[model samples]
Target: MHRVRPLPNYLVQRYHGWKATGYADNKAWYRRLASDGQHPRAMVIACCDSRVNVISIFGADQGEFFIHRNIANLVPPFQPDGDHHGTSAAVEYAVQVLKVSNLMVLGHSGCGGIQGCIDMCKGHAPELEDKGSFVGRWMDILRPRFESVRDIADDKEQAREMEKQAVVTSLQNLMTFPWIEEKVNAGELTLHGLWNDIGEGSLENYSPESGAFHPV
Candidate 1:
């Protein structure tokens, strides 16, 4: 039998504290959300890094944004093969069902997944190159973008550029989906790419015209 442990005490205590305070203070809003369902205007694809808080950064309340978190904040190409594609599924739901008007891909500095991709591409992370490594396979989505930044002599600069490239790669892949492309062409949906400097608490918006990320 597979063993499943109970919730840790600290987490339980935290949940109780939030239930008593945050939940109690917003009981009516919670109830309304439960009854009315979510009608968020935007969908955000962000990294699974603990430091990257999509809600706090945007000052968004619960249900205000349909957010999807994944390693490196990646969106793979539109592959309709019979396979489990969590990120793609989320995008389909957000676009087809929820009909969100905006879709944003948010990347962050010092992302472990991005670093892992760097190490893997440089042949430094052998474990990640293993056939059984899920992370390695997932990071492949960003592998093609690594070549664009590889010529940078400074390691830190290369990593930073690669992180921003993650956002760009995802944005490009988002358009590969026929529905997303159709909506974008028809002006029903708009796509955005953003990179956040975690330690500095700064955000940059990607501009297609300038082909670069600028401070937001």
Candidate 2:
């Protein structure tokens, strides 16, 4: 079956109309970026969920941010064994090449990947175990966290707290890179862990003092 793609006329017309706005002045400026290369101010590691697109969420102009999206918004520890890790590669380019000033790990509520990990940990998830599956291993990235926060709550409503902890874990993993750690210690780059709660259309900042996500 062929997929239905949005008509080119629709996209082209939208772009042409958007070019008239002051906010979209960069639309043409980005046309020059193909030859100039992208030099974004921030690098965002976000989730692959369709509703959680980082570019549209931040309302950033083209080439303004180097973004990487993966299941559950994960950033695995750096490894070198001839394995191609797309997320890590984007991180390297953003930090090493573009030299972005900020690195953000953005998480959202009601993430299917997070829920999958939660279900697997609770022994109720059966979908991933039957086939030649990598879900078990991929979800291992979140295993330690699930164990850490499972004792705090036993219901879906309380799982929001666990999601907050997972963001903290991702921040900790970010510093595993020597360059990132040095930059952070030297105040060259700032690391942020943010949670976007889709349910209430709210944004939360991870507060170290409270050990919870606080609305900004």
Best of the candidates, lDDT:
1
Backbone N/Cα/C clashes per model: 0, 0
Which digits, one per residue and each the tens of the lDDT, describe model 1 over residues 1-216? 479889999999999999999999999999999999999989999999999999999999989899999999999999999899999999999999999999999999988999999999999999999989999999999998888998999988899999999999999999999999999999999999999999999999999999999999
Candidate 2's residue-wise lDDT over 148-215, tens digit each? 76776557654776667667878887888888889889998998889988867788888778777777
TM-score leader: 1
Q: What is the lDDT of residue 59 in candidate 2?
A: 88
Error of 2 at 52 (Å): 1.0
Given candidate 1, what's the lDDT at residue 67? 98
Model 2: number of backbone collisions: 0
In model 1, residue pairs whose N, Cα or C atoms come closer than 3 Å (at least 3 residues apart or on different chains), thus clashing, are none
